[model samples]
Target: MRTLEALATGTPLVASDYGLEGLSVDSPGTPLGAMRANDVDEYVYAVGRLFQDEKLQEKLSNNGRALIENEYAWEQMTQRYEQVLLDTCSKYLVESQE
Candidate 1:
């Protein structure tokens, strides 16, 4: 949720690589490619990169904001959850009939 907030606000971010089971990083079309840090050195490097490169920062900020607005909005998330529940129930019903 913190990441979502930062993305929504167009903040370039550096974050730990752990605990992001559902969050995607390091994708070709994603702004989080270089922002996932596995250690202190990687974290420092990521922050330094953001600090030194204004163009990169701007690109990440724009992409992050767009990603959140398009994919992570509250309505979109709720729809996805509802779809998952419906699919799960359908599968369970089908299996039980066999």
Candidate 2:
């Protein structure tokens, strides 16, 4: 939730892999929305790099905000959840009629 908030606000991120688990941010073949770091040294390096690199920061900020708008916004999430429930109900009805 916190991560989503940051992304929604277009804030650049330096988060641990575990902190971003299950998110599409660092998925294979996708652009990263946050810098991934797992240790203190890595975190420090990532933060420093992000701070020093304005282009990287802007890229991350835009990507993160776009990700949230496309995938995690309330409208998008509600639609996905509604579809899941509808599919489940339809499957159950078909099975019960069999």
Candidate 3:
């Protein structure tokens, strides 16, 4: 939830792999919204890189915000959940009729 909040607020992130678990931020062939850093040294390097690179910061900020707006927003999540429920109900109805 904190990660979603940060993304919603357009904050650039340097997060651990564990921190990003279960999120869609690591899709293949796509830029990540946050830099993944597992250890102290990796965290330090990622933070330093984030601080020093303006373009990277902008990219991360935009990607993160877009991710939240597209996938994690209340409206979006509600729609997805509603669709899942509808699909499940439809499947159950069809199976019962069989």
All candidates: TM-score: 0.77, 0.91, 0.84
The alpha-carbon deviation from the true structure for residue 1 of candidate 2, after best TM-score superposition, in angstroms, is 1.1
lDDT of 1 by residue, 1-98 (tens): 78778878988867775534456655676555237787989888888988899998987788778878888898999999999999999999999999
lDDT tens digits, residue span 2-49, model 2: 888998999998888777877888778888798889999999999999
Task: Show the colliding residue pairs in model 2.
Answer: none
Question: Which structure is stronger by lDDT: 2 or 3?
Answer: 2
C-alpha lDDT of residue 28 in model 1: 70
Kindly provide the TM-score of model 3 when superposed on the true structure, using C-alpha atoms.
0.84
lDDT of 3 by residue, 1-98 (tens): 78888878989987877788877776797667888889999999999998899999999999999988888888988999999999999999999999
Highest-scoring model, lDDT = 2
Tell me how far the alpha carbon of residue 81 in candidate 1 is from the true structure, in angstroms, after superposition. Answer: 1.6
Between 2 and 3, whose TM-score is larger?
2
Go through the candidates in order and give each one's C-alpha lDDT: 0.77, 0.90, 0.87
- Output the better candidate (1/2) by TM-score: 2
Candidate 3 global lDDT? 0.87
